[model samples]
Target: MTLHRFAFPTAIHFGAGARKGVADHLRQAGCRRPLIVTDRALAALPVLAEFRSHLDGLEVAVFDGVFGNPTASQVMAGAQAFKQHRADSLIGFGGGAALDVAKVVGVMAVHEGHVLEYVWDHPQVRPIVHPLPHFVALPTTAGTGSEVGRSSVVSEDDTHVKRIVFSPQLLARAVFADPELTLGLPPAVTAATGMDALTHNVESYLSPAYHPLCDGIALEGTRIAARSLRTAVAEPGDLAARGDMLMASMMGAIAFQKDLGAVHACAHALGAVCDLHHGLANALMIDTVLAWNFEAVPHKFDELAHVCGLAGGGQAFVPWLRQLKADIGISGGLAQRGVRREQLPRLVELALADICHQTNPRPCTAADFERFFEAAL
Candidate 1:
């Protein structure tokens, strides 16, 4: 075992009407002109208008270049927008992709080189010597919890390989998590994002890391998601259920500081090769990978089953996940969800290369990854 470090460092203004505080939060931080970094679809929605309505005393500009999976080019484009408007701060306003681009826009704006130079794996990665712009997040969805996350995941323009820009400084200065913002989500989006949250909790808890604090948070996060996801999807107007999902999403993001496991590795590979939505990718691969992983840590599965209120403990966990996915209209394997059988070699290679699987409770090999993809296919 190795020494571990634990830190939970985000100021959260949660619950209904939390979005109303963004203007004041910025003012207190001495920011006036702030760039609203968001996806084009979200930028056109009434949610963005309503959110903007609350910022009565500030000069606001919208940079709606973000779309699909976040990419290094999007970050550069957003940084250009930030400079053109001479924005003093940033407001990440949308789901994970938008928020991820927003998190790094300032990094690109102030840094000397290309955005890829900041990726953690870059051999000559530049240090974040200058202070990043004052940035805050307003999550409009109950997934990814990018609002409270400390890293920005941006994919390459050509290869589509996801590169992680990780640093404590990348964390949002504050997070405004208002469940009302998620009330407009369609049933499918709600289900996929909810599963993303659940996968974060489950995979983190299954990691072979030694963070008891994260383990406790992960279990409780799993419990919250288990009890609330169905309600959230079935009754989109149920604010309480929406709020529970939001809390669980943030808790999952926070808990994954302990690290994630093989599910994420598979999901990341799918995202790169198939361009699948990150949440949906996680949803598709979770059951298959976990079923295989069950043999490695049956006791952990027992703990998971107990938290989810399953009767058969470890024996019941994977089956419960499968049922849950079907209940929420996410019934499918990788093939059904658009992953081609021919992409197996690339997916397996990418999965094996992904850093997330290195911490899996069960050690995995190239053959295991090939088997995981084949089984799911």
Candidate 2:
């Protein structure tokens, strides 16, 4: 038997009003001053103001420099904001991009070098010797679940290649998963991010890594997303659907601690090369990659089909995913989404470089990646 370690350590406050407790939680932890790391767009919204109202008694500063995908420069700027305001804690207050930047702000603030040097692949990757600030997350969208994750995916400022900073210390001290915060998301964003949650569950379940705990979470997360995603997108005000999607998003994030597969590999490539939204990239590539991945893990596909309520079992799973994408407003292929044929070579190369596919049940080769991109296109 092989021995594998498992941990589920983030404290999550889930419900309609969970954001209301953030100030008290920080106070109890002796965090009087906190930096709210978020994007420029979210900063201009009323939601930010409303969330800030809950922290009325506490000293709060907002860092709204995060835009596009999280980047090295953004993390550096956020760290500067943290020092400038003398923040004792961090509140990640937007979508995945903002939350990813928030997770590493403290690393740059207290550590010795540029944020890229801490990436796991760096030749002299700096060790995370000191503790990060007291970080809490309040997600304004239901994707990536960066709030509960122990990793941050920040892109290089120049090349736009995504680099991951992984450490247990990056995990948020607590997560306020308030579905109300997601109720304002546009239909297109809801569709894309919901597909991202579904893809995480699907790909994690398909990964060959040995982690039954993650397998169980991934299946249930798949079920929840299958049932609730369309409703959430159609009726944005439906708190129940929004809440289920939120739970599914976090569950997918937790389950992926077992790691991911080719879908993520392709999606990360698209994010880096085409400047695509990570969630949308996942949405675009999931069915194509899963269709290619099916024969290698037929039993797993059958299990996924069962949970997703597809009567044709394994064979129906991919078709159902295709329909779901169309139903939720994510129609069309990669080409329709602005991916050019000339970019295919670079995408394949980047996909091959991404670490996510190492755990894929079907071992992916360069030729396989090229084929996957062509098929998706």
Candidate 3:
């Protein structure tokens, strides 16, 4: 078994109608006026309507400018909105992009400097110094697990490279994980996001870091996603399935702070290079990267197979993942998703530079990344 230190960072309020008490929770946290950070797409969806109804007339300002892969400019804009509204806190409400922007917004609100100056692996990066505005997250999607995480992935405007901004202070003060908010998700969103949760679990477990608690949570998260994702995708209205996937997503998020592996490196590159949906990109590249990594850590795959209910052991997990994605309608590899053959060099460069791959069970070289990308294609 692996060994490491662990801590539960986010206070969680879970169950049906959980979003109803957002105002009370915010008030208790000393937030009288919070800027609700979300995407333009979800500003007035039925889920947001229900959330507003739960607030029972407590007024809140909203910045709904975040759309798909949040950029540094969006975070800066959200911070400006937070200041303009005289908002004392932030509520990250919507999908991963919204939540990501919200987290960084809270950082930018209190700290002086450009958001990129605090990016995780950047040279010339500055340290966070101020206490952030209180933040509460109510995730509308079960994927990305950004609600419980301490990091946000933001794309750079000029290069479009995805940079992870990490700080323990970015963790939400509380999370209202209501599965009811997820019921309205379309089938494609549901499938892709669920698979993202699965990738987190599998990659975290396979990472060469020693974190037994994370390993345990990773296995259970994998189990939850395997059993619940298909049901949630097919029946969209199944609260039980939705809730399980939600829990699994949260678990994956917490577990992966021990860090991820080649899959995420590749996924991050795909997002940067192609502007593809993060989860869908993970769904496409997961099998290819993990297969490349299988020879180095076969035992982890064997354990993964056992947890996911596959008949075969280590060798079976990759095929099972590939089929699982196919069965749920996540189509094709990198090329099918619009990555050109000529772009392989850039993708490989991005993937190799990504710090996420440092803990990969197998050291990924440029040649290996080319083969993996080729295999994915």
Candidate 4:
């Protein structure tokens, strides 16, 4: 095995009631005024009020206009809110969408251009502004691990393209993973996000990279998700299960720095065009993509099958996934989720452009993506 270096930049605090540490983290970071970016649903929750009360003397402004998949306009609105309040830091206090938008707000606020100007597709985009405002991410979901990641996903308004914003500076100054906050997440959200975590782990393990550490993390993360996600979803108040899922989620993000593959590529395209939930979309395509990529790395699946406690080798993994999805009430495929056959070609083109495509185990062409989409449908 080749030598590889793994870097984890963010300071993480994990457990029940970890949200209580947010104020102190802000104080330590020397932030007096911070912008709290979240969605309207979360903003209205009592947890948000409690968090605000804890902030007491610290000036905290709320921007709750973020939607399912954050848009460029939403980032602009968040940036405006940050600027208007003269926020010295950002508190991302919800799921992946909210955190992504908050990271974008931090990036665009200090930079001297429109959010679209820094989009990945823009050839002239400069490196993100350095030493951006202190970001403190508090994850209310048990997945997405946006709290620890250096990239943000923002959608383009005109073309509906979901663009990835990459910058090491976008990583949080600190992360608070409070399982108590995740207790109120709906069962569907819990199941979908958990599968998303599973996808991250699986893809990272399959990545043709030299990062043995990431491979180990990804394998163990998959085990945690397999053992705990169902229990977490079934018994929302189970602190142990929630904590394990939280760890698994963070591990999923960290490990995927090695790479993600075709499942994410396809899911990103679906999210761009159909407005489907990111995690659920990935869940729907997981089995199909796994089957497609099986030939490239069969033994990895065999190892995963053993780790997941399934019966056979590589083939056992797919059935295990199907059973898990069924138990979680995730029974539908892309067609059931409103993806039409006519959309395949366009989605394939978009999937091909996704950054995740670069790390796929087997080289995937437009035709390959179409076949995957059709098989998934």
- Which pairs of residues clash in candidate 1, taking residues 3 or more apart in a chain or in different chains? none
Superposed by TM-score, candidate 3 places the C-alpha of residue 149 at a distance from the truth, in angstroms, of 0.5
TM-score per candidate: 0.99, 0.99, 0.97, 0.97
> Model 1, which residues run further than 4 Å from truth?
1-3
- Expressed as tens digits, the lDDT of each residue in 1-377 for candidate 4 is 55566787778998877888888888987889999999989998898998888887798899999977889999999999999999999999999999999998998888888888887678898777566998899988877988889888888888889887887888898898888888888889999999999999999999897788889999999999999988988898888988888889999999998989999999999998888898999999999888889999999999899888888788889888999999988996788999998988889999999989789899999889988998888
Better of 1 and 3 by TM-score: 1
What's the true lDDT of residue 345 in model 1?
Answer: 96
Write model 3 residue lDDT over 1-377, tens digit each, in one string: 54456788679999988887788887777778888999988996776766776665456888999997899999999999999999898999998999999999998998888999999777988888888998999999998999999999899989999888998989999999999999999999999999889889888999878888898999999999999998999999999999999999999998998799988998898889989888898898898888888889888889999998888798999888878887888877777778999998999999999898999999989998889889889
Which ranking of candidates, highest lDDT first? Answer: 1, 2, 3, 4
Tell me the lDDT of model 4 at 42.
93
Q: What shift in Å separates residue 98 of candidate 3 from its native position after superposition? A: 0.7
Indicate the TM-score of model 4: 0.97
What lDDT, from 0 to 1, does candidate 1 have?
Answer: 0.94
Model with the higher lDDT, candidate 1 or 4: 1
> Tens-digit lDDT track for model 1 on 219-302?
999999999999999999999999999999999999998899999999999999999998999999899899999999999999
Q: Provide the lowest-lDDT 10-residue window in model 3.
A: 50-59
How many backbone clashes does every candidate have? 0, 0, 0, 0
lDDT of 4: 0.89
